[model samples]
Target: MSITDKNLGSKAIQWQAHQNSNSEVPENTMAAMNYAWNLGGIPEIDIRQTADGIIIGIHDATPKRTLSVPEADQDKLISELTFDQIQQWDAGVKFGEQFRNEKVPSLKQILAGLSEHSDRQLYLDFKQVDLEALAALIQEYGVARQIIFAHNNHENCKTVKRLVPEVRTMLWIPARFPETAVETFTHIRQTGFDSLNMVQLHLPDAEEKQSWRYKLQKTFIQEALQYLGEAGMELEVLPYKFDQEDLFELLDMGIRRYAVDEPSVFVELLNRYFN
Candidate 1:
């Protein structure tokens, strides 16, 4: 099916909030997701495994960027810290004082809390964890169909399918695919992921034509959409920044699944520009 057919389903486009409405405050925090949900946006969170193999909602591999940590402890990877130790560090202070009380939420906490919103679609991005363990957690919560699991490893995806075939899955493509279209498609097909996601990092103000990287990514993704669509895979893109005309261009290109940080902004933009 085409990206349009797979994602849009008669809507203009489906927008997922990056790291759960991260454009507002402390990213990957429950508050961000709550705001996103209140605004009619799909919540997205990246899960990282702690030292003891517990899953937590954290975007980066470490707490250096998102959490308040001693400079000496800045280099500690998520795998090096226990979930209790990891949660002790304040995840909200760096953003502002109002959210200073926020702590990192465990995958279990998020799943247990949000499972009631059966219609709310959640994206769970795996950083470095066993898919089987993650699958087990989802199964325990009885939310296998409500969550979309994402990872870059094709082997991991295959394992996820083997372990929990009912859970939805998405593949993450990096900035540089570094292979022929056919070769990439082969890997994607072998993985049997239901959807694909890629990040578009561009300065908000720069002209789309001024950046060679943007041009390259644009060309690559355009072809990728065609290949995946023909092979019955859907595509989703996380645009770091966008404007009304720019977004309109993307929609015209048949991109129906967008990963935008500010869902309310896009909602308003779409309502004002198209209406």
Candidate 2:
């Protein structure tokens, strides 16, 4: 099915709030997701399972970046820690004084919030988690239709689809070792991934002066639109950083979905220029 068939957003084009609009709130926390939900953007979150098999919303394997972990525990992975142990660290204090006591949230917490808002949609970026447990939890919450299962791993995406066909799946390509749009489309088709709902393309860092090979040019966008369009899969772009020119160019090329750190800014630009 095309993205248009999904209830992700009312707009034909959608802006996915990366890391739950981290520019406004702490990354991968409920606060960030709430902010993104209020802005009518899909809240993209990274999910990992703890040692006890509890799924939590966190990006890194370690809590060092967004959580207040002790120096001694800095190198520890979330998979090695129990849920109770991992939740002790403050998730928001490092971001600002206003967000001092925010605790690490679980996948259940995120899903509970999504269940409240029928219009809300979530982009679940798969990390280290049990797909069966995740799928079961989503089913239990009756949020199977409200979340997008996304991962760089094609097998995971396919597995989730097999587990819950009602849930939409998105496969994201990493920026490292970039592939041509035709090559990407061909691979997706050959591998049977073209049957999925969406395929996300990574836009290289706009300000990067060095990595010319990683840059996604206008021709690449056009080719992606053509080939992916024929394959019946929607293509979404996630940039390393927000760039207005690049975004506008993509809009002109008929690419509508984007995962961005700045959701409010992207919406404003969309309204001013394309709306």
After superposition, the stretches of candidate 2 with alpha carbons farther than 4 Å from their true spots are: 1-11, 180-184, 192-195, 206-214
- Candidate 1 overall Cα lDDT vs. reference? 0.70
Q: What is the lDDT of every predicted structure here?
A: 0.70, 0.79
Give the Å error, residue 38, model 1.
1.8
Note the residue pairs that clash in candidate 2. Answer: none
Number of clashes recorded per candidate: 0, 0
Model 1 worst lDDT window (10 residues): 197-206
Best lDDT goes to which candidate? 2
Q: Of the candidates shown, which would achieve the greatest TM-score relative to the real structure?
A: 2
Tens digits of per-residue lDDT, candidate 1, 1-275, equal 11133334655456678773466757888887787677777688888899898888898887899889888878889999999888778989888999988999988988997788886778887777777788899899988777777766666666776777776667665443234433555566565433333322222232445533232346656776776677666677766667777777676667767778777777887665455
Per-residue lDDT value at 203 in model 2: 75
Q: What is the C-alpha RMSD of each candidate to the true structure, in Å?
A: 4.5, 4.2
